[model samples]
Target: MSTDVLIVGAGPTGLALGIDLARRGVDALVVERAGELFPGSRGKGIQPRTMEVFDDLGVLDAIHAAGGGYPVGMIWQDGQRVGEHRMFDPVEPTEDSPYDAPWMVPQWRTQRILFDRLEELDGKVAFGLEAVGLEQDEDGVTVRLATGGSVRARYVVAADGGRSAVRRSLGIGMTGETVDPNPTLVADARITGLDRDNWHIFPPRGEGDGFLAVCPLAGTEDFQVTAQFPEGSSVDLSLEGVRKVVAARSHLAPEDVTEVRWASDFRPRAALADRFRDGRVFLAGDAAHIHSPAGGQGLNTSVQDAYNLGWKLGAVLRDGVDEALLETYEEERRPIAADMLGLSTSVHRGEVRRGEATRQLGLGYRESSLTAETRQAPATLRAGDRAPDGTLGGVRLFDAFRGPHWTLLAVGAEAPELPGSVRVIRGPAQESYGKGLFLVRPDGYVGWAGDTADGLPRYLARAGL
Candidate 1:
């Protein structure tokens, strides 16, 4: 009946947060209204930045084993392969940024991986237990569940979907507009007569109809079928309905769609919560922001949201740091969420391509209150930038940053005595990160940078080192 942190929802956001907290030994509980994990392949694209996060979280190997690189898009007209279209700009992997491409894994599989990781860390999730009402005080939160039980926690997170019951219980309002008026049906189906090498696209034959794209889901024997409908049109999610749509749009017959594994329909929209926090409760993922699934930013942003909040919560609860550190969650992530919302909308409207911006490697908290740049002239890797990965002192930087701790990269600089909690890696100057003392945060961002350790101790003190 009691926990340190209670999370609502078992989606990628909640599962990811649970994994981070469990690894940090935080007493957290994840509750899902549904009996099982999400059954669809929605939000299947994992951005490179999220891949890095997964690497640190100890699930990258499994993710790599279960997913594959996105195939090129194949255009089709009158049942003939016409041309090839690249969904994203090509980028080569480098020492600084290893994962340069988006990896495809069904969202359901991603959640399962996170769930298994959570269990390995002794974390727990109660399915079919929905938080119907919530009340918070100076000490903790008391949540009323639909299953006739109450859970008390020091803090609560709403990782539920856009129609978050927890957010509603707190009376939070979301403001935004619909990204598209037309309804879209996205489904995972087993089909024949299609090679699993490229994403097949069939343009609408007439004005009253809409576009259809059937993409081979990597690492699976299934294809994700996405079809658009006219404005004010209702989407049909039945197997027969899907067959009709496919047969009418493309050359595939109705029986080609042998099985409809899972299906859902929605109109693309973007909305951001009025606020992410209220007293001891917070909103994250779709509970915080909603995005059109164009540039594959929604799930990645949501997972990063959990990553951002996990360390702060661990610090406050496990390490006895100031609660004010929790304030940075909203301060830093809200702006990023807003920017990603705009980017997803733009990508949906065909204004931008899935390029470098969509990778999310360049996003950082340069203006955050926690960032401290003491150098007179900052280089490409500033204090508020992501800590680039490279070999330092015969060790990979990511290996040093794997656990729940800060890392001090004393590249080409004299090392100083630091707290045991902060891991220090000394090495020669690397091209990506110029010679300097770079203090990496627990979430892999450069928190402080200076020519020496003159201000390092001061910064550490603020973080309760």
Candidate 2:
């Protein structure tokens, strides 16, 4: 099958890119190495910024309806109830606000929502398809499908999982370090001594090797456990090994545990692909970067990477923008992914010392020429900042509300009319007014966000909005 964009891998990243492009009416084909969706949980939390992306995909409701709500709060190490404070809560993205809280949802559930949205858009990701080889030239890229045939694409996006074929084909090296092997045992288990109400974090109890974390699993009482792995071990995440880690960190005995669902050996690392784009081919999600799953960033970061790349690709396909516009994908997303890696690493490191945040508010994007005029400090526009959502009536309209068209949540006092091209919502302005009326794109990232002076059309023109 020929497509304007050929995406490999249907994990959150590939699905996100596919949905983003399809929402914008771009023809995209997403191929995954796996035979089907990731059935079990992987990344189990969602940040505020990513919530906005889900909104854009028009699947937040389904996600929330499925397994999306913040029905519970975050928990701490000492068995004390962890408040929402710890979850990087940046005030609403309003020009007058400072932060918001990260949402909690299992990665498998999130992937299901994304896949459903893709289907709604009439896009289907071919599962069990591998990319053995591909050919690209000056104008377009040709992709080989493991399903027996091939696809010719105007562009290719390597949403492929770790060890990406497209990235290797382009010879991109990953630049980052493997974190200090905080060897941990992770598994699905049921325990009588522990409570599943909140995410439980147990730092090497009085005399243990590492930390033990108990995260809630959807549809059941079993919680996911993570603790130090034994000295000499195999990848086998059996109940006994899971019990060993739980006993090592927490005071819980594994045998008292029942209903072992799933288990695995996990090590956190930070990796950023040296380049996000090579010629007409690009990388998104794990194909572009890999990092510790500590902060539940794997799915969110990968999803957002494609969210940022989607509109640009759609524009290129529509013959409305120059190819150079696509460069912004890496120029923008790479730093954010790098930030996720660093922050997750920090949170993981803090597990040893019982501490962390570099800030949910501490993250944002002030670097791109897009925000240059706003003169907003990097702190307000840092690459990793939390996006905002609004309290409307009895309901809440998040900053990430996606439209079939572009939207301008006019954070300024007086909202202007810009025809039907952009949806303008005026109310209390952003606390960081200098960041201006945020011009949120359909994919949820700031396309041309700045102060009111920047105006609408000009912001659109600056970004080819």
Candidate 3:
């Protein structure tokens, strides 16, 4: 089959990119090796920045409905509640930043939501099909599948997980370090005698023991169990093994641990690909960067990767923009991925707190080549910054930016004559945005800022507006 984009893996990254491409009327297909969607609660914390992306993708309401805010951490000693611990530093919602904290949703539920949204948009996902190898020419890429069938596409994205076959076939190298020598066993289980309010934490009782935490998965009856093991220890994922660990660590008995729905073990490690792209194939999500699950940056970063590349791919294929626009994807995302890797490692090592940095609201691309700042002196809001949400001329800024179109906010500055494709919002100066002509990209970052419309036309032309 022939298509415009061929995405490998049906995880969040691939499904999200498929949804974005489908909404833009791009012919894209997602191929997954697994027979069904991933069934796990591995990456459960959704940061605030990702929440905004979900809003634009038309899945924010479903995401909010499927999950709830994180519960406080309850420390335990001798089967009694000792003290309360906060998982994240408390932050209140503001006008510009509405989602101030992380939301808890099982990874399985999140992927299910994204898949449903993709199908709602008529996006196609072919499961049980794997890309064993691929060859790209100047015209397009031809992927060889394990079923002996092939898919031809103009561009390809490898959203496959950490051991990405596509990335390996391209000979891309990843450099990283093991964040922790201890192995961690994570599982979803049905337990008794544990209230579904706070996350119960059990400290190591004696030497050679490890910590155990049981957190109630939001919007579900299952509780996620996590236990640490000493270095070089083998983890048992069977029901009896889980029961033994739970009984030994917490106040629960073997009978209280009723079932083990899903379980896995892994040693925390941080790694980044040598390059995100090689020829026509690009790596994304765990295929591009691997993160420790401490600060909840892994899944959030992966979804944002798809969000960043989606519009650019649409622009290059559908719009008459230059293909050079695609080059900025790695240039913009790689550094951000590297920074998030460091943050995740820090949070894993207990060197950093999960506060403003973990929220991912402050991430921006001020140094990117795509950003153009024409103003001699800019205020707090400048080019390469995220476009804050507020009301302008009785119109909600987010409502104006909810679609797959560029937004031009003329706040106390006259908007220049532009193409009909760009959505323009005009009003007096607002408290958050200040007074400026801000050109917002499809991904919600300000590409250019100016005091007037003097240089907006040029910036828009360069941005293919």
Which run of 10 residues does model 1 get worst, by summed lDDT?
375-384
Tens-place lDDT digits, model 1, residues 267-385 = 99999999999999989999999999999999999999999999999999999999999999999999999999999999999999999999999999999999999988878789888
RMSD of 2: 5.0
- TM-score per candidate: 0.99, 0.80, 0.99
Which predicted model would earn the best lDDT? 1
TM-score of 3: 0.99
Q: For model 1, which pairs clash?
A: none
Q: Give the lDDT of residue 219 in candidate 1.
A: 86
| 160-207: candidate 3 lDDT, tens digit per residue | 999999999899999999999999999999999999999999999999
> Which prediction has more favorable lDDT, 1 or 3?
1
Q: Model 1, residue 91: displacement in angstroms?
A: 0.9
Per-residue C-alpha lDDT of model 2 across residues 325-375, encoded as one tens digit per residue: 787778877788787787777776664221223223334555764453352
Q: lDDT for every model?
A: 0.95, 0.67, 0.94
In model 3, the worst 10-residue window by lDDT is: 455-464
RMSD of each: 0.7, 5.0, 0.7
Q: In model 3, what is the error at residue 157, expressed in angstroms?
A: 0.4
Candidate 1 residue spans exceeding 4 A from truth: none
The residue-level lDDT of candidate 1 at 428 comes to 95
